[model samples]
Target: MGNITETKVYMLDTNVFRYKSNPRAHKSYKKATKRFWRNVLQEFRNGESVLYIPKEVIRELEVQSYTLSEKENQRIAQLLELIEETVPDLATPEIEHQIRKITAYVRSEYKSDINAARDMEYGSVSDARILLAAWQYDCIFVTANIKDFMLYPLLFPQNESRLFDLLSENYVIIDPTVYENIHRDPVFAGMLQDLHNMLER
Candidate 1:
């Protein structure tokens, strides 16, 4: 009812998968993960939706192996099996330029110093890559931490107009707690109905 929603083509963030794999992480996130499988993946496997896991997200997950239990590792492995791995075309000048700007933007926002030594070490570059992958594939970028990605456009309104458009038209940022009751909540219920109609078409 708010806007025409895209039911297919989703690009997932690392945290979305992490919450599912790690049992002790957070109850709400785990519930969101379960609901995502029930609500989204069912349609995805049925050929109604396309799902992508960026290579950068995969790398992030791999690095998290040190803290994960064997069961968590197994869950992550199985989860990866269900997604289509996407390698963002980093060769594009636009993408490279955006990544740099996005990294700097994140540095300023999180570290309060754009030239902080953290640089690529703080996970900004990888986040940029994942977002660009969504843009490249026209996939709805899915994440529980929406603010992390939304900060880019807020800093560079003119240069990131396309991203603004993408955010408005395709971004599917969901709060974990809200997502757990998606069908019961009015706002999310409307979104779900919109997606259902789109998929049926």
Candidate 2:
């Protein structure tokens, strides 16, 4: 984690809103996720940081919520209440242009691999917008699906170098299913440390 300390803006992905208990996950992992969100709420309440969810992510969550279990739906509803700031509107022409360019790049790059192309095409537009929004707004993009966002830089480093650098220095990746892979974002690391300390207590 970087030593940089200042008020921060965090751009959250849709998956971060999920707190559904998974049967296969260890109990501690679920507890950690809950603690993570609790810390988020604390930060929000204290106005120490800004948490932003793109409008696209919110819409995606609403669509997915329809198929989720009642317990999970309730958790999502509670999580939604933590949105203290307005959702960032990602529908501008500039954003649309970036999304199209990214889509074209993904398609052209993965032309030889049909399955890869399909996967890229599936959610690339939305993912691209989210990634771009994080970059555009200079916000730390937090998500459980690190690989998905990391794929852009790994594939096309030339255009996404700035974004790559930002993510490297400030982002947070929280894999809800496991305790080990949660990484980066100094603020979040501190929060995770506090959670660990509480568990020890």
Q: Name the candidate that leads on TM-score.
A: 1
Model 1: per-residue lDDT, tens digit, 1-201?
A: 765555577787887778777879777667767777676778876777767877888888889987889899898888888786566544344444455554444444444332233222223556657766676566656776654465333222222232212212333223333224332545434543443343344
lDDT of each candidate versus the true structure: 0.57, 0.53
TM-score of 2: 0.55
Error of 2 at 147 (Å): 2.1
Give candidate 1 misplaced runs (Cα > 4 Å): 1-7, 89-123, 151-201
Listed in order, each prediction's TM-score against the native is 0.60, 0.55
The sequence of per-residue lDDT tens digits that candidate 2 reaches over residues 56-80 is: 8888888987877778777777776
Candidate 2: lDDT over CA atoms? 0.53
Query: For candidate 1, what is the TM-score?
Result: 0.60
